[model samples]
Target: MPSISQLRKEEQALHALLFTQAQYKNYIPVKSDSLLQIAEAYYRTSSDSLHKAWTLFYLAQYYRDSDEKEKALSYFQQANIASRNIENNQFKFLLNLHWANLLSDEDAENKGIEKYQTANKYAILLKDTLKQIDLYGQWGWCCLLTGKYDCADSLFNMGLKLSTSSKMTYYNYLLNCLSLTARERKDYKRALELVNRSLSLAKDSTELYPLWNNKGEILLEMNQYDSAHFYLSKDTRDYDPYFKATHYLNWSIYEEKIKNLPKALEY
Candidate 1:
């Protein structure tokens, strides 16, 4: 059997093939299944084990997005265990950070934070500035989600400053983080500016989806429901849950207002 790296290469090639044929979109599940088969086969034969972990991680994402939470959690945990066996501190830290993020358990969240911090420290030691920026952004969002506003603010500011100073365009992820923080702080104007700038430069699907979602959320909060709905409807599967939930909430609010507005006149 081929190793995990070989299987991963095949998956990448498959992705390339799919991109060349818009028709492959119809058979996405078949492609996913094939990818998983290769992953499983790789797991059975690979000795280093990290490749198997990586395979599970990729499959877990596929399942998660497909609304299979249990399977995602299972694979994510498997990836964490595999990560522990590796000698590379940086990769291990990266795996822990991701594994922690995928977990819904509170204990897992704490563990994830611990791993994230460790990864950040190691990344600094390696002078892997890009990964450092990414880790800060990830940890910032984790803190924000967990209601640690001060920690979130500190991490976001640190990452944003480093990204800006380094002129690393890939680090535009920090802009999104900044926009999120600003919005949470009720600085809608600043949030809008940061989000719009990112949207203007967003070239790929990964970048565009978040930018649109963020813009939609801000617009919704500003009572711009129509624009929010339009953007939210663009891609249902890819946008952030926070953004999607807010979009739905705003839509409901607007609908209720429309229904109840005329009746209020009687009072």
Candidate 2:
């Protein structure tokens, strides 16, 4: 409930905190202590009704990606509380979307789908088409995860078309979603084609991580082990090492295909 000037200052501080946090995010062993310091800084300085809400959203996503589900959920709730205090429908929708996706337990898929729908509606009302497409993509993935292939396919198609149209900015997201849909359909050739398109577009942006990962996955599915290895190896060392586990898993399958049981086992 601070004045507009106070709100602007709080928003600026939150933005600065996000900028600093981005520097350490690509590392697998992300410095959690550093992240905690940033969160604490924001908590101390945030005075506006919405600033803390926005800050919590980013913190929740960071924890979610770091595999700290409990912490993620806690911040997500805090974000909701802050958003409610400000009557900020946009932030509320966004926070709900995040909380929905983070609740990935088997029992949570239905609730997640419901929240995604609600978020999508609010995003549309706000004339935030880009976020709507992104939400659709996330919702599609949720459907896919829940074994609702038809629903997932429909949602992805909508998102892809929207992204490919006027908002050509998010074309990479569209391509990635298409690749995911193709993979789900077992259309390895189409998946490879989609990933190739993504890589071409990603070369012009900072979204190289998804480009490399999708290409490697498609090559792995195509049984192109050596080629897959080359793609994965080209990724920056700062990229998560857990993805290396995927490379090894694909190599194991390749060894099996070549009738090298011992090598496969070793892999």
Candidate 3:
């Protein structure tokens, strides 16, 4: 059996590993496997309920990131059950937030919305303005997925109103959501305007890539082939896989717009 000190060290190491993975937005399969092993071991051996809850939470996040939905949901439920005796509102808020995010996919959006509302209550009790803003943004996205444009618009604007100069990233995210809402409404002009605003706030190429993709997609929708090609051609090799997929999908559409079926297929 690992000593308490050893368990603590392992838990801290897990936290650092998770933070690094999140910050870089890159997942190495080998590293993730190792992380899972450590988390599983810790969970089995640790006597501390809170630490066990955290371990289960990390396991849930790992499965979530890997798109193993059933495993993720099971671990989330276990984590929530473990956390029931703890007094960590912040952890609970994060737990529910992520749970909601995962559930927001496809058929479970209403359940996700309920979880987000629960998270919102915890956010209120914690009195964390930034967290509240983030919750509103995520909740808006859930609403958007559920085809509740009005609800999404209202939630996004609520976050926007709470944003400040120091919170430019969150502000930019809100603008992106608003742009999506505008696009959904077929208000291409407003969508373009909102995305342009987001672009102006971008500090680097990493930030600019997705915005460029967004602009390209909007222009494509507007039948502006030349403009769409211009934005879509910007290099996005550094983007993560999901964004890269979106970029290529948009590029394909641009090629099709010019009746270059071969080029579209190549993209």
Better of 2 and 3 by lDDT: 3
Q: What's the best-to-worst order under TM-score?
A: 3, 2, 1
Q: Please provide, for model 3 over 1-267, each residue's C-alpha lDDT reduced to its tens digit, 9 standing for 90 to 100.
A: 454345576665566445544643454442364655565576567667776787678778778777889999999999999999999998899999999999887468778888898899899899888888999998898888778999999999989988863464688878988999999989999999999999989888877777887788888999998888788887566446876787678778888888999999998
Error of 2 at 187 (Å): 3.5
Question: How many clashing pairs per prediction, in order?
Answer: 0, 0, 0
Q: How accurate is candidate 3 locally (lDDT)?
A: 0.81
Error of 1 at 256 (Å): 4.1
Candidate 1 — which pairs collide? Answer: none
> What are the Cα lDDT values of the candidates?
0.67, 0.72, 0.81
Best by lDDT: 3
Q: Model 1 over residues 160-225: C-alpha lDDT tens digits?
A: 788878888655677777788788887899999988877777778778877887777787678777
The predicted structure with the larger TM-score, 1 or 3, is 3
For model 1, the stretches where C-alpha displacement exceeds 4 angstroms are 1-46, 50-53, 56-85, 104-107, 170-173, 187-248, 255-267
Off by over 4 Å in 3: 1-46, 164-168
Better of 2 and 3 by TM-score: 3
